[model samples]
Target chain A: MTGTITEAAGAADASAPRVREMSMQQAVNAALRTVLREDPRTLVFGEDVGALGGVFRVTDGLQEEFGAERVFDTPLAESAIIGMAVGLAMNGWRPIPELQFDGFAYPAVDQIVNQLARMNYRSRGAVPMPVTLRLPSFGGIQAPEHHGESLEALFAHVPGLKVCAPCDPQDAYRLLLQSVRCDDPVVYMEPKARYWDRRPVELAHDPGDMPVGRSRVLRRGRHATLVAWGAMVHRCLQAAEYAAEDGVELEVVDLRWLKPIDAEGLAASAARTRRAVVVHEAPLTAGLGAEVSALVTERAFGALAAPVERVAGFDVPYPAGPLEPQYLPTIDRILSAVQRTLEYKRP
Target chain B: MTDTTERTFALPDLGEGLVEATVLEWLAAPGDRIGRNAPLVELETTKSAVEIPSPYAGTVVRLHAEEGEVVQVGSALVTFAVEGPAGEADDGAAGQAGIVGRVPQDGEAPRRRVRLRPPEE
Candidate 1:
């Protein structure tokens, strides 16, 4: 009779989840709200985060509800913002600090890359650096100089920092909540371009359900696989939509966590289709695309019908104003790369 | 003889890249006269609940959406029977992008929004 017991836990966990239509900005706001309500030791602070509700309004209404003590604003100093987080995290507090923009994070690189990234290792696992650094990253908002930049390659290169970028509203909420709850230092990159994009988000998924360092194949295809994250993930999905009209079904993979890159999942997707194209907004030379390309080539070399293609930004600095469109890879560019992979010859 | 004009005041962008909101409640009904800066409708955006204001002193000729109805930005909220010509109501003044950087546009948005970090099964 004891052996007759079946594992119905998976079915119970799959009970109807709450699916609400929300944008990435709203999802982030919800995540912060949930954290502040659940954890008394968690604190949110940054420039214009309290009263102004962040420039993107991602932290909107947290101050009004949580009070200034828990959700407060800091001075317009990036280093101080991150330094404060390091101090608070050491003192039994979980601090979520904001750098305003991707370009602004440079001022805090010393604190982030040197101190924060090394604290846990320096302490030999004694100090758990529970700090979540929120950064509005990547281009496409036509931001002026020092507003839009892609720093994933820099952060992902860091040894101890956990890097992740959500591609949709649901992941935005779940991943942020998970990152805040993590014991290590997490770099939470909020895509500035997809903040307003709306989609039906399954809201009932708890933290750790989709843990960090995992990739999801959004669309399954046998012809070729498209790998991307952040804003480029949506662009790749759009390219797949257009390719479907031409009887070409492209598999799209969303690598949510950049740092512990999901090599197994990336390789599986590449091995299945025998053709893989990695797309990103970062520059091509030494960009994250190169790392992804190398991972794909290393893990799935024998299964490949062609070499992995990377459609990425140019090596020059991220252009400003009207020149961004030319610098960032377009849907046409991704499709062209896919076409090349499909038409590959032994020559 | 009273000569009047009508202007359709659509929902303006609520800032922070929000494209639509659900009508929580409507303060003024049709045929009601209201002044500028008057509280018009309470909307529940994804962020928080906000009350919109009437543009100018005008007679409300029509209510475009009922309570609990989701209204898209740039869609008509209320048509006003006012005492001025078209383009004078100044309803679009609130649609300016509040944050730094380029604003988000609908369908094929060149200056679209982006997110980072990081999920799903």
Candidate 2:
């Protein structure tokens, strides 16, 4: 009954807004439909986005609804996709281009990091790149090489681009809408694993509910805080719930925005809990986990009770197929990290 | 796993002590009712194109390797939901029955023929 399409008690009433149980895919599809319907200048284009829908069928019926000119496809070229978005953005068209997959964005790094990301500053505020590049990112689906790489650190390190990944269907809908509306070039990373994740989404279309660069606390606890983003957020929440059964209170913080991370939000929770553990799918070295741990340590050092722990992927290449379960941080790994932070002592 | 009998057939020796073969095409797909000795997949090893025969009569459950993948000798090629006894997997002693021709995948051409298993007794 969770993922099945269910109607609320009030049948066909016009009094209240509809609350539908939708998968992240349907929620995002609805968001795109709303954006395309509302804005005339907005154009959605990318590889296989036309008749093929998408590799994941995320853009299932856009071209039929919006016509060929507005929702179209490009040749299988990632660089050209970003280049055309910047050109259209300069010409007063709001462009929302899908990079197809996370690893595919590597082919367009120059267009992303150097040109599209920095064009506004180089042109001295004359050009605002209102381009939202949707990249289906992260692992857990055991995709082949170059299909499931976690490249958030690469994009978040860049100064000009704003990076954000949403965990649930609600965030997936709202953050996508917010990313499309923001003037700054945003790399909207949708966790590929959570695409089919079902949740009751309030279809109010409030993109302004939570702005980009803000983090939200999904669960509250006074012990250690499990900080994570994207697909790993759900895993951390599971660990928190499991920890609660053992009389251990673990706070779960969804660090939604990778870039411009909410330092105050992290410090506020970490200060109260006195311990923190960062989890991510990317490898540990120079990863966003390190950044989160550093930020928490820097801001909450005085209030901290123990050292911060980071449970992340091994410092090796992201493995494919059968090796992935061992590579990814499991719920037990997160619980162990929380236990270590809880049991730490001064030597 | 319990309800259906399945066999994960591995790539057999095409001929002459070959180690690997590139899958050129799949002649059978999942849900297709396959008969024993039917053309299962086309392969190229050492510059020869060859087709491997199915070992059991069953519904194709899954294809372990995709086309163009260089599957190693004795690696999983296909899994079939067959009708058979609850018997233990045969050991590798009778793995190489006879090399009729050579089969290759990934790095070269494919040719020749080698039965995956003796006809079900």
Top-DockQ structure, candidate number = 1
User: Which segments of model 1 are wrong by more than 4 Å?
Assistant: A1-17, B1-102, B109-121
lDDT digits (tens) for residues A195-310 of candidate 2 = 76779987665656577789999999888888999988988877776676677777899998998899999999999989899999999999998999899999999998889899
Query: Residue A329, candidate 2: how far off, in angstroms?
Result: 0.8
User: Candidate 1 - CAPRI tier?
Assistant: incorrect
TM-score of the first chain alone, every candidate:
0.94, 0.94
* lDDT digits (tens) for residues A1-347 of candidate 1: 12111211121345544566888898888778777766788899998889978878888888998899988989989999999999999999999988888999999999998899999999998888999999999888776787668899999999999999998898998888789888999999999888988888755467554667989999998889999999889888888877776778899999999988999999999999888999999888889999999999999999998899999999888887668789889877887788888877778
RMSD (CA, Å), candidate 2 to true, equals 13.0
Tens-digit per-residue lDDT, B1-121, candidate 1: 5556787777776644556779999999999998877888898876578888887678999999999999987888888787755555455533332222444553772332221110010
Please provide, for model 2 over B4-93, each residue's C-alpha lDDT reduced to its tens digit, 9 standing for 90 to 100.
567788787664223578999999989999887788889987536888787776799999998999998788888888664536333322
Best by lDDT: 1
Q: How do the predictions measure up, each by TM-score?
A: 0.76, 0.75
Point out the worst 10-residue segment of candidate 2 chain A by lDDT: A1-10
What is the alpha-carbon lDDT of model 2 when measured against the actual structure? Answer: 0.80
The TM-score of predicted model 2 comes to 0.75
